[model samples]
Target: MVKKKFRYDVGILFISAVVLFVTGLGISQGTPQKKNPPFEIDRFIPVETCADCHSEIYEQWENSMHSLSHTDPIYNRVAKFLRQGLIDNDEIEEAESCVKCHTPVGFVSGFPTRLSDDLTKTPEIATRGIQCDYCHSATSVTKMYNNGLVLKPGHGEDDPGIKRGPRDDAQPDFHDAQYSKLHTESGICGTCHNVKHVVFGTDLETTYTEWENSPYNSPDPEKRVTCQGCHMYQRPGIPATGSTERPKNPGAATDYSDERPHIYTHYFVGANVAVPAMFGDEEKSNMARERLKNAATIDVDIDPADKKQIHVTVSNTGAGHSIPTGLGNLRQVWVEIIARDRGGKTTYEKGVLDAGSELPEDAWMFRTVLGDGKGNPVINIAKAREVLSDTRIKAGEQMRQTFDMGFVPRKGTTITARLLYRGAPQKLLKQIPGEPIEPQPVVEMAKAVRTF
Candidate 1:
């Protein structure tokens, strides 16, 4: 495509400019000045510009997870880590794939694909992340996943082109607007939410696929629940889905808009509390915690007749996909079970951390694990020989496990199942460059108590 070709030069020129700046040619006062990034630094249309007219939606999304997609510290460290220990051409391409979805603007501009580029020096628009213009300017989805949304972005503010949305009746004064049927469809969200490896051709993340096979995905037009239906419309206390009553959210979308009976909210909140907390966005972080708590349900039971075993059942009641939905390689979800006798003596325990804060061998991990050809665990998608295991509970599925006790349950024996989640595993976090992250917050999603 002509557009793809145009984007290629931007990275080269940007890199060259950085070289010039480092050598003092592009320096201004104390800061380095951008000497013309391709497509202008405003090709994506600055977030503040969109905020001028759509203040309320802008405010809602300003601190949302989507806004932090590119700037996320963990994402940056992990993505940048791919730049190291690569010799093959195919491996290099695999490393470059992260940008396609995380920074659509930079991906489109063909800059920052190298993975080694200093992101802080990139144009402001590229770092603004998955902002409004990139999503609104989408013209079509060329593929089912992996940043396949074909965009027809306007040439900056002067030629702000047609912006697409769910409403067919919208009439905006500032720019050309059109009702895009694709905007309402789950396929649009699938375009980026699903990730497939470039070389291995394996699906690393199947959030969209998981929903497609679930009961929530109905064929009937009136009954179909989309990614937007739950995620966009969710609030702090309310669950994303799986509840009997989902009250409509009603408000004016913008400052100049009239009140509507139902408007899809823009929090774009997910089950990720770590990123928001790291950025000091306490409000969003707490909302994530609430979302996680409401995402699943847990039940504990003892065999009345046998008295030698206990069962813990966890249901993926709320989510349309897997519970720990995104990037199973990074996310950790496990069940910690504790049992005690009459005098409060710890009779049985599992899911405790060892010296390095790593989960012990007996930890009941509920997530996917990648394996190399020779049966070694690997996190890099490019190096993955195959998926060895996936223990995460799928949508509408119940995962039941029975724990065996050496002795019969006493009359005062108490057992508890605490389902917990964390941002990443200790092994993966240790590989991150710079200061090591210790004592990551562990959130308890579901809890239960039983006595015999």
Candidate 2:
């Protein structure tokens, strides 16, 4: 709670400074200096500082994937393996590569630290993990070979040298206010959200690229939706509480089409509940769970007379990228179904990974497994040679699966069934496998359902 308050306080002051700078309202009368401010403008304004006056917004953000960008255990492990490869091959320095996104502030401050830097120890800096200032401070982006974010700290909001954001509320208790165009576009997010491999340049992570080619980004002018349209909206529960600036829908079509009177949310929520839970943030994990629940639909089907055939459908009603898109080799999504008879005996089961084990046998999860020239699965990132197979669910696509089983229903009764969807499947293993293992069969996506 103290962290939250401190973050908000920082956010308030930073935002005020930005607004005043951009609006040219708080410029001290003096000769224009040729050099930029001496403050470490490159450092990100940690999240906790934004929690002071914007407590609500801070809470929402603390629950988002953005807040956990550097702390996710799975990501941390994968990065370690990759970094070791870089170090052994003498390709890059140890802290230089990972700190780009994980500890932008530390990198900016010239502190050579590992991803293990405790944000709690440096509460202000920790809160800035992929934080408000880090993003808003970006002056321009040069998308060349890798995910390069050209930084001109204190550039946005007229060189405020403080926190920058999208808000229009009247808060005289804080710094000045100013509106910025960068805050409204997806380009700002593309800075870090998009990732590319330095060695192969094969585009390991390309959420922004996928969005650019998506129907949502139609350039036809008549049919198009910005990334913000889907991710941020008055979708019954996701507008920014601190922002007074509403969305301007030039093509207003409904009563809800009017300006929202506030900016979209900064939670930057996604379908990664397991990670936050692992980080000791139960509230954040729960929020991720709710967001995932609200993002899709599930259905189950089984013939009454013919109990052998069971069909399930999962629809990607939400999520702009391909379901289970990024870090495909690491991230996993699958559906588990269990059928029971009147006596509560299990008739059939699917998608169950043994406790504290790797992915279950024949689990129909969404992911991409890399392989070597020998046509075998390759787990070691350092040894990975090429792509093997990818079975991810596409946006707006419904995945269906049919299972044949022999479970007779009770006389004049139906069998009870339950279907579960999980985000990460191979989370238990501390290290990845060395050899190719038997991969699971892919069932189209599966939804939830019950029999009468």
Candidate 3:
């Protein structure tokens, strides 16, 4: 009996040692150490306070998706749907997971599972969504992927260690500014952008990983581009704080200095026109449309041997990550092809929107499909247990689709190919009944024409 017990004890010690070694290795390689802690409400200064000096930047942020993430009616409705339909049905953990990124302030304040139907009832800071303080106050990230940010709240303007930003030379009179290299890297953005299922442990969003694996993340400076480079266009401007006429680089004594060309604007533009349009911000909606137009390019080719055979090529040229990067399960991107004769009669059409705003059965969609444990399609990401398939176009990559034109008229025909993007799938929108679902507009990313 004593000998058997000693052997068992030895086996337990070996298993413990292996676990310790693996854990230490994970820490060395920057795996997430722990979950995010509760936010300190008092440490959060209102965005209006920062706007006192950074009016221009504040305006830009006010028009961004980050600003409207929480207050958007569609997002609120979805949260409610998840809560009432799923969380109330015993899937409480998954519902809480979404709040970590969507409403980090609320999630950290110990209200992760609750989302009020009335916007006024929601916490003020939570309504701010991905606000400035929640990002600037981050001391470090526990990992590069997933929501593993470690925040160290700053106690208002008088606090010694205020906010950390990219500029090392910035010296604002109102608050302390320290240089943070992490802010300049893509990993910081990855802290919140990359999301994994809280219950199933499946990756739901892999925007950062897609960028990391692409040539855009190359070590060559000329070939490399950070998330901020494209999203935040740079221009010669005064400091975000202080007077508009103030110098771009203000000295310790003076409020302004000579102009510098490296001031990165805070537009934070992405392919999100629907939310801005819903919020009644035409300028931001237009900006989003323009950004989408510049994100990709399309090429069309016809086979010489078989005039009926056509090849359409779509390339994700401008974006550093995949063309339809974040929330792939919800976002929809596809190619719309139409061929017409000289009389303007339609010869062939694919990806046409039906009367109900639904894509045709033959539409080639670039998205990720999720499935439940039973292998059935799952609309709510919280219930997803497996990634059935992902057919998105990667950064600096091209995808070609071959289509049979069938019998074409003897006269020359014009074929038009357009890359289209939608913020959310129509099926998902239909799930939220009785909210007067507005028709989500589809933005054209790129277009090409070919005559045969």
- The TM-score values for the models, in the order shown, are 0.88, 0.68, 0.85
Task: Write model 2 residue lDDT over 139-223, tens digit each, in one string.
Answer: 5444421234555555333334533446544232333444555566565666566554333223455677666656655545454
Model 3 worst lDDT run, 10 consecutive residues: 238-247
The residue-by-residue lDDT of candidate 3 on 1-452, one tens digit each, is: 43663564466447435544653343312212235556556667888877776666777788588888777777877767766656432245555445567777666665543444244666787778888888888777664444667787777556725778877787777778889877887877876887766545567888887887888676677666777766666222311110112223222222244345655566676777878877788878777777777778999887788888889999887777887988888888999999989888998999988898988867988998888878887877768878998899988889998999787434578889999998886776887867568767999888999888
Model 3, which residues run further than 4 Å from truth?
1-37, 87-90, 112-120, 157-160, 234-258
- Candidate lDDT scores, in order, read 0.75, 0.52, 0.71
Name model 1 segments beyond 4 Å from true. 1-41
The TM-score of candidate 3 is 0.85
Superposition error at 158 for model 2 (Å): 14
Q: What is the lDDT of candidate 1?
A: 0.75
Candidate 1: tens digits of C-alpha lDDT, residues 1-452: 43653464365347434543543332222111233223444566889999998887887787787888889887888777755787865556667667667776876776665456666666778787788998898877655656667777887888898899888788888888999977887778886887766555456787887887788777665777888888777766665666434568888767878888777777888777778778778878887787788778888898777778788899988788897877887688888888899899888888866678788877878888877668887888766656788888898888998888767967898998899988877887787779876656789998999987
Misplaced by over 4 Å in model 2 are 1-55, 71-74, 81-96, 113-127, 144-146, 155-159, 162-180, 219-225, 233-260, 277-280, 303-307, 355-358, 380-385, 406-423, 426-447, 450-452
